[model samples]
Target: MLGYIARRLGAGIVLALLVTFITFALLSTSFHDVALTILGPAATPDVTADLIASRGWDRPLLVQYGDWLIHALQGDFGESVYTSLPVAASVLQRLVVTLSIIVPALLLTVVISTFLGVWSASRGGIVDRIAQGISLIGYVVPGLLLAIGLVVVLAVQLKWLPATGYTPFTEDPAAWARSITIPVIVLTIGGVANLAAQVRGRMIDELRRDYVRTLRTRGVSTGAIVIRHALRNAGGPALTVLSLEFIQMLGGALIIENVFALPGYGSFAFNASLQGDIPVIMGIAAFGVLLVTVVNLLTDLANGWLNPKARVH
Candidate 1:
């Protein structure tokens, strides 16, 4: 297990480095006139050239990347070209806000999907069909539309919760919950569809496996047979989908954050990209890539633990 974990961790770190390097190289090469973009077009050509030279924008891309990467390793991501704030500071602060909302949403997605999937799979026919139908709707609807509809009907019409904005949980717990509820709901809609459907299908497959039938013939109760014998192996593929959904929700968060006006990594990335703030853009991209890679590694570890057959392969 230790070796397995070490291997996963090593692979994740290597992948994260590669992602950051590739992102930095791509941004550097693809975009031109960074100094002018941030400095404004009205600036004179000499001023622009001076600004670019002063900022080392004229340096070879590799040297720039190397300096940035070294500084990043030492916990300095440099100052934001737009905000002039340390990139790491801004990213981390907003990252906390994002986690407060999205983390709960991810857990909720897992729990809700797991329950619905297991129940629906255990009982085929009407229950399965109903679960499938709901999953279909969730899978089909775009997150932006779902967020809008939820805001309109639930918050605007019913007034059950505040329609938009966020408050820190430390400031007021109730307000925090109220603030994140809509965003969480929006992310969960898609997450449930992604996770539950995969789990249900996987469960059905496991239930039909020869071992499951043998367990039943040994006089095990139906629930025990399904939960104890089938679910362990069945959960592996479901977990894969669940992890992917986590990453998907994070990506979709760009839309949801803007809609709700929550200050999060998504909004930061959006604004930074729009303003040509390369530092913040690079920071956001690296953070996201690392986050997804770590989660994928953890998912693999979980799958191996849940189904030991995974470890052998």
Candidate 2:
């Protein structure tokens, strides 16, 4: 198990490096005057040239990429060309805020979806059908549209929550929850729906297996059979889907963040791209790549633990 984990970690590191190189190459080739874009038209030509020179854009692409990698390894994400602040610091501050929102939202999603999926699967009638229908709607609706709709109904018309903006938890925990509640609801809807569907499908399959039939033949209690026997077997696939969705949520929160006016890595990356802050953009991309690689590696390890026979080869 340790060897397998070590190999997966090594592979994840290699994949992250590849992602960094690709992002660096693309940004270098596509944006010749990244510093100029950040400085705007008011800056003098000489000042812009000096900014470019300082960023070492005139150097060969490989040299620039190497410098960026070295700085990144040292926890120096480079200074934002637009704000003149360290990119790592700016991103980290925002990341904490984003995680505060996402973590609770993810937990809520897992609890709600797991219960709904199990309850629906246990019943084989209209309740199941309705649950399926709700899941479909949640899956089909785009996150941005759902966020806007939530703001309109819950924040504007009903005045139940803040429309958009973040309040620090230190200031007022209640207010922070109130401000982000709607966005969290919007963000979790899709994840819950997807997880519910996956869970329900797995449960259904597990219930039909020969072991379940044998349990039924032995007159095993339905609750015990479902909870202990079936659900445990179903957990492997459900966990896989959940982990993938959680990772996707980190990247996919951009549109929802914009709609809710939350300052997060997604918003930061978006603005950086629009302003051509190549260093910041690349840093964000690298961070995302690292997150995804780590998540996938963990997922693989989890699957191995859940079904050791499958990993025996």
Candidate 3:
């Protein structure tokens, strides 16, 4: 187990390095005028040159990357070029806000999708047909459009929940849930539908296997066979989907957040990139690599646990 974990960590580190490198490369190539953004259009050539030199932007790309990486390793991401705030503090605060919504939405998605999937698979005919139809519709609709439509109906027309803004769960749990309810529902609808389809397929396949028939011949109940035997076997893939969707929600929350006026990492990244805030952008990129690596490792661990025969190594 220790060896397997070590290997996973090693691979994660390598992947994270590659992602950070790519992010740095893209930012360097695309936004080469950090000095101009900092000094403004009215600044003379000498002024921009001096500013760039002072900021070490005039150094070789590799040298600059080395300096940044060294500082980042020591938890020094530097101050944001745009806002002058510490990059880590700014990013971490927004990340918390993003999680306040995404974490609940993820749990809801898994529970809802799992139950629906198992039901549709166990009870065919109308149940399966309806589930499939709903899945298709949800999968086909764009997230932003769905969010807007939901907001217009649920918030604007009915006033069931707030249309925008996030309240802290620590401060007021009920209000927090209410504030995030609409966005969570919007974020989860497609994931739940898609995962339900996958789970349904897996469950159906497991139900038809010879062991399921043997269990039936031994007088095992349908519920026992489905829940105890089939569900476990079918769960590995569903778990994978859930993990992937969670990551997507984490990264994709930007659009929903912007529409809803939630302060989050997505919005931070958006503004940072737009303003060529190298420190914040680099910080976000590094944080992204870490987040992806950790989530993926968790997924692998889950998959391995679900399938005893599937060793982590």
Candidate 4:
């Protein structure tokens, strides 16, 4: 197990470095005038040149990336080109807000999707059809439209939750929950739509295998046979789907955050991009890669536990 974990961790670190390098190269090379973008049109030539030289934007891309990476390794991600605040601090602060919504929604997605999948697979008639229909609707709908519609009905009509705003969890727990309720619901629906189908399909395949029959013939109860044997076997593929779902939700969060006026990592990144703030953009890129790496690592560990064959590879 230790060996397996070390391998996965090493792979994740390598992937992180590779992704950051690519992102840094693209961001660095894509712009003709980084200083002008940040400093604006009215700035004099000397000011632009000074900004360029001071930030080492005048240096080769490789040298700049190397310097950035070295600082990043020591926990310095530079400062926002506009606000001048530390990039890491801004990213981490917004990350907490994003996670507050994402974490709960994902937990709910897992529980609800797993149950619906397992139950539908085991009872293969009306139950299966209903579950499939709901998932299909969810899968077909765009998250942006869903979020807007939800805000209209839930917040505008019902006045049950706020229309578009975020409250800090530390400020008021109840308001915080209310603030995130619609966004979380939007994300959860999309997540369950994809993951439940994967779970159901995998569960159905596992249930049909000969091992399942063997377990049943051995006088094991139906629930025990399904939960202890079939679910475990099916979980490997389902876990893969779940991890991909998480990454998808993070990407989709940009739309959701804008619709709901939430101050999250997505919003932060979006504003930074609009301003062409290279430092903030690079910081966001690095953090995103790290997050993906961590998620993939967790999925690998879960898969290894569920299927020892995974560890062998």
Candidate 5:
């Protein structure tokens, strides 16, 4: 198990390096324009040239990447072109806001989806049909539309929560929860729908397997067989679905952040991309790759734990 975990971590590190290298290579090509954007239209050509040289944008791509990688490893991602703020600092600050929504929403999604999925699969009648209907409704409703509807009914009309703006949790935990409630709900709906369906399908399949019959014949209680054996087997696919949903939520945060006027990495990254803020963009890209690598590694570990056969390969 230790060796398996080590191998998975090593693979994730290699993947992160590959992704960062490719991202750097792609972003470097248009870096000259970034220099121009920083200088603005009033700057002379000589100024732009000097800016490029000073920033090492005039260097060979490999040299630039090497320099960036060295600084990045030291936690110095350079300064934002427009803000002059350290890229890592800015990103990390916003990351907190983003995760506050994503983490809680993900937890709720997993718990609620697991219950509904398992119950539906086990009960199999009106419960199954109702669960399926709920899943379909969640899957089909676009998040933006749902958010708008919620805001109108709950915020505007009802005056229960703020329609926009974020409060730091440290300052006011209750207000913070109220501010993010709508956003979390919008994000969780899709995940619950998708993951619940996957879990239901997998659980149903696992329950019908011959091992389940063998367990029954061995005099194991129905609940024990379902919970201890079938659920464990079904969990592998559910965890895979969950990891993918997490990645989707990260992307989904961009729109949600903008809509709700929250200070988060998604909105920051989006703005940086539009302005071609290379340092900020690179920092976000590296962070994203690192996050994905970590998530995949954890997923592999969980799968290995749930099914020992997974560790063999």
Candidate 6:
């Protein structure tokens, strides 16, 4: 298991490097004047050139990329060309906000989806049909739309919670929950649907397996057969879908964040891109790539643990 973990970690690092290089190349090539864009067009050409040169924008692309890579490896992450704030500091602050919301949403999604999925799979009647319909609605709704509807109903119409902005949990626990609850629900909708579908499919497959039948024939209680026998086998593929959904949620929260005005990494990246902040944009891309790679590695380790046969292969 240790060896497997090490190998996956190594592979994740390689993938991160590749992602960094590609992001750097694309941003550098596409943007002709990063500093000028940040400075605005009204500035004199001489001033713009001087500003650009001061930031090493006059350097060769490869040289710039190399320097950026060094800074990134050293945890510097450079400064935002637009705001002049350290990229690492900004990202870290926003990450805290994002994680506070995302973590609870993830946990809720897993628990709710797993229960509904297992129950639906085992029953397969009107209850199963109702669960499927709900899942379909969740899966089809766009995140931004869901967030808007939630804000309208819960914040505007009902006046039960704040519509936007984050408060630290330390400052006021109730306000913190109020600020994030809607956004968390919006973000988890698709994840819950996807995970429920995957879990249901896997559970059905497991229920049909010979081992499950053998356990049933041995006079084991249905609950014991499901909890001890089927659930373990169903977990392997369900875990894969769950991990992928998590990574997708991490990378794809930009629209929801914008709609809700939450100050998260997604919002930061979106603003950076709009302002043509090349360094900040590249930094966000690098962080996203690293996150996805790490999630994938963890998924592999989880799969191996759940099914020892996978480890052998």
Model 6, residue 140: C-alpha shift (Å)? 3.7
Question: Model 4, stretches more than 4 Å misplaced?
Answer: 30-32
- Top candidate (lDDT): 5
- Candidate 5 lDDT over 89-184, as tens digits, reads 999999999999999989999998898889899889999999988888787898889999999999999999999999999999999999999999
Q: Candidate 3, 51: how far from true, in Å? A: 0.8
Question: Any residue pairs clashing in model 6, and if so which?
Answer: none
Off by over 4 Å in 6: none
For each candidate in turn, give its C-alpha RMSD to the true structure in angstroms. 1.7, 2.3, 1.5, 1.6, 1.4, 1.8
Q: Give lDDT: candidate 1, residue 55.
A: 74
lDDT of 2 by residue, 1-313 (tens): 7777788889888988898898888888755466566677688888877877876887898998888899899998888876889887888777777777777878888888888788788886998998888778787898878888888999899999999899988999999989889878876788888898988988889888999889999999889988898887787888788888877788777876788888987888888888888768877877777777777777777777677664633
Q: Whose lDDT is higher: candidate 1's or candidate 6's?
A: 1
Among all candidates shown, the one with the greatest TM-score: 5
- Model 6: how far is 29 from its true place, Å? 2.4
Per-residue lDDT tens digits of candidate 4, residues 119-187? 899998999999888878787898888888988999999999999999998999999999999999998
How good is model 1 by TM-score?
Answer: 0.94
Give TM per candidate: 0.94, 0.91, 0.95, 0.95, 0.96, 0.93
Better of 5 and 6 by lDDT: 5
Each model's lDDT comes to 0.84, 0.82, 0.86, 0.88, 0.91, 0.82
TM-score of candidate 5 versus the correct structure, residues matched by position:
0.96
lDDT of 2: 0.82
TM-score winner, 2 or 4? 4
